[model samples]
Target: MVLGGSIAGLFAARVLADAYDEVQIVDRDTLIDVAGPRRSCPQGKHINGLLARGQQVMEEFYPGITNEIFADGVPTGDLCGNVRWYFNGVRIQQQEAGLTCVSASRPMLEKHIRRRTAALPNVVFVEQHDILGLATTPDKSKVTGARVQARGQKREKVIDADLVIDATGRGSRTPIWLQELGYGLVEEESKKVGLGYVTQHYRLKSDPYHGDLSINPVANATLPRGAIFTKTDGGRVELTAYGILGDHPPTDQQGFYDFVKTLAAPEIHEALMHAEPLDEPVAFRFPTTLRRHYEKLDRFPDGLLVVGDAVTCFNPVYAQGMTVSALSALTIRNHLHSGAAPQPMQYFQDLSKNVIDPPWEMTNTVDLSFPGVEGERPLQMRFAQKFLKLVQYAATKDKAIAAQYMRAAGLIDGPEKMQRPGFMLKVLLKGIFGPAKKTPAPPLVPIAGGHVETWSEYRNAA
Candidate 1:
């Protein structure tokens, strides 16, 4: 049984269906053929894109799914060459890295994955049900199943299962449930980032990206504000402007435009000037990046495991959540290939050491670089931040360095790849001697004559 029918649970169910006779996905939301964001996923309305590695993993799981999404009008492109990436207001040199980037909204991507998982013969979705808690054995050493209650019903019932996986996301009740079962509390590590972002869709009078998929002005310590202006499945564009350390984007129309004006990418602000608003700006706040040290636990019940944001919730700006969840699913597949239930300790150990550690360290290092973000930055972290800045500077001059940097950022390669002697020497030489040329700002095009209206005005007219 998989608890929570989001992307993580859906992936788990898909993998479990191959090993188990029947895999049941339990969620409070109606899981079948629904479009748009779910009430459970607060960040669903924001901009989301699959990194190169994530696209590869998803394609591996569901063959031809990428083409399917593209057929539905979602754009695809080379990770580095086709997307505009800005670091500290300087554009990274574009190069063909042969990496795939799927620019799809969170809802559209999830909808496609959910549809594929639902079509599996052995997978069933138990929708509109609240997950009461875990049902354990007499000694509470083994999980027998899950207790769930249908929506609006007082009666609760237990669904028996040989194995139970928790993909309940960051709000997982696993810790409290484990404490009740006599097991000690799971260790947790959190870094307070105080991130807030506001998103709004736009129907542009003209294409700003030309043929590119998106424009990203990544946040940095010097200017802790950024935005992702990207093309989505529809004939509209999505802009998610963000700030760190309590600096939040506004939901009001003029306030949102001012926020965009503050972004390093002036093109985004220029594009929005002529765009017709499709919806009122919506905001989401993420207080901290959280991780449950499940691997550190000495004792865990058999037949119980956790995946996705239940284990780690990354800073969304990095766009690592969905990718990490997909990787977790792959780990579960490896563990289940033995035809026996996975050992909790061994699985978590592998997950932490292999899957979670890299991105966790990367994001943490970047988050701590911001002086406003409250976290202890030791000497190593300070040195890493300096080196990363050097690399970013070099990336602006050298396409090879830019491609390699994007490879690491996309999770296609480990951070260690950046530290190799050859790479470090190249970065140093380029930084010291490379010609510094200013990248020309994108041309500000005039808005063609049209009566563009805000969403509120459009609604009022109707």
Candidate 2:
């Protein structure tokens, strides 16, 4: 049984169908046959693209998934050569080779995944039933099934299952349900980003960028601004601009234009100025990056597992959610293939350790750039930041440097890959001889209720 029919749930269901005799996905919203937005998916209208790693995972889990999406008119392009990435108002120069990433609307991608999952004879999608509680054994030790309530239904029913997986996303009530089952309290850590998103779709009347995806600007420590414009599955484009903290963007027509105008790059504003708007700007607020450590629980309910956003939700700016979800699904497949039917805790611990580490480090380290987030950054983080800036500086002049940095950014290589002797020597030489790019002045007023003594100290404290 899978709770919540989001992308995570669909992908999980797809993987589970191979191992289990029957895999059922329960969703609160009405599941649709066509590619359209559901009530639960507020971000559906926004731009969504599959990273290279995510695409590889999808094709691995379900063969020919990318070809299917492309057949549906989704645009595919090289991540390094085709994409225009901007960091700190400086455009990343193009490289010769990069990963071929696919771009599509949220609805289009979900629709394809949904179709693929639904095709399996062992899989079923149950809709319009909100999950009420977990049905456990008499001793309340193990989760046997889920209690669900459908609107206008006379009575609730218990759907039995041998195993239960929660892909309910950031708003999951699984933690509360676990506590009700006499399981110990779940430990949670959150970093409040105070970020709100404003997204609008437009009909691409003219392709000034010529079908290429472009980012207006990357998030800077000093200026928290970024935007994405990409072609979706149906030849339409979705543009999203994010504002930090209470710096919310307006949903009205003029307000949307004004918000685009505020980005570090002027191109997005100019594009919106000329394009025809297909949808009104929709606003959604994400309060924090949340992770629940169910694997760390001393006593967890048996036959229950959590995946995707319910496990670790990163800030969406990094676009790691779907990729991480794909990784979790892959982990599930690996466990089943191994023929070791260990406890769900064992499965979750292994999955959390393997799949969650890379994206977490990459995201949290970058999150430290925000002025208000509270965290401790070790010396390695400072070294990494300085190294990245040097790489970026070099990438501007050399295609090979740009390719290396893009590969790392796209999760093709681990952070330690840069620690090789040859790369380390280059970084050291660049640090010594490269023209020192002026670092932005730190915020004059302290944000965390204290004054930072110096930039080095501030980076360490963050």
Candidate 3:
């Protein structure tokens, strides 16, 4: 049984369909018959991408899934040739080989996955119901089922299952549920980002960028500000601008335009200002990047597990969430293939090594560079951050550096690849002779609630 019907939940159900006698997905939101909006996912209204890694995993899970979505009008792009990346305002030159991804709105992608999951013979979707508690064995050592309340009804139901997987996302009730079941409070690690986003959808003109989605530019810094404009499935484009460290966008239309004008790249602003507005600007705020240390818990009740955003939520600037979910589904598949009961603790330990380690390191490495980002910096973190700066500086001139960086960004390789002999030599030579100065201090210091204020706080404050 899967606890949520988002991508992670659906993906998990697909895999379990192959392994288990029966698989059921439970959710509080009514599963709408069409590919339109639902209440559970807010980000579904915005643009989202299937990274190279995610594309591969999705294909593996549901064969020809990518082609099917693209066939429905979603365009695929070569990650290096089609997409553009900006680091600190400088465009990283594109490269060739092994970098390819798919672009589509979150709704279309979920529609595709939902259709596939729904078609499986042994899979069942139980919607419009709330899971009240877990039904355990007499000794409370094993979760045999879940107790649920039917939506808009006084009736209660019990769902019997051999295994239960939680993919309820960042605001999961699993921790509270577990504590009620005699477990201690779950260990958690979090880093405050104070990022705010305003996204608007537009209809592109039949011009240079109308049907082609070859370039998507992003800028993420201490004062992380960037814009994303990409082609969606139905001849539409999504233009979104976001700022980290307290630079929230105002709701007024003119203020929105001015906000985009401040981006490192003009692609997003240009598209938004020039294109036809399809909808009003929708705004959302994300407080912190959080990770629950489920693997460290000494005891996890048998027959229960967790995955997806509920496990480790990263800063969205990296666009790592869906890829991480796909990878986590793959991890769950491998564990079942090994003939083991779905072990929650063991699965998370493996996840930290597989799905979580690379992205966590990647995001946290960048976050630590921010002046007042509140998090403990390990000794190796300083070296890694400086070394990455060297590579970023070199990437401005060398396509090889850009390719390697993209490989890491795509989760195709670990950041430690930068420490390898050949790459390390180039970074060293560049650091020694290149005109780039030491990376600057973070532009602001953290104030209350781990929010940041301008650097002048040091000199002007009482």
Best by TM-score: 1
lDDT ranking from best candidate downward: 1, 3, 2
Candidate 3, residues 1-462, lDDT tens digits: the string is: 899898989888888888888999999997646587678898887666667888888899989887788777776666765566667666665677486677778888888899999999899889999878788998778888888888899988889999998889998888898898888788998889887888886664322232234444454453367777666667566676777778887767889989887866555665454467778888878889999888877788899888889888888867889899988888888889866677777788999887898889889988878766788788899878888877777776677887888888888877678778998888677644543432321122222322112212211331
Query: Which runs in model 1 stand beyond 4 Å of their true positions?
Result: 433-437, 444-462
lDDT of 2 by residue, 313-413 (tens): 88888888898898888787777786544377887788777888777877777787666777887899876666766776565455666677777767777
Off by over 4 Å in 2: 96-98, 338-342, 428-462
Error of 1 at 141 (Å): 0.8
Clashing pairs in 1: none
lDDT of 2: 0.75
Native-structure RMSD, model 1: 4.4
lDDT of 1: 0.88
Candidate 3's TM-score: 0.90
TM-scores of the candidates are 0.95, 0.89, 0.90
Q: Which structure among the candidates has the greatest lDDT?
A: 1
lDDT by residue (239-318, candidate 1, tens digit) is 99999899999899999999899887888988888788999999999999999999998899999999999999999999
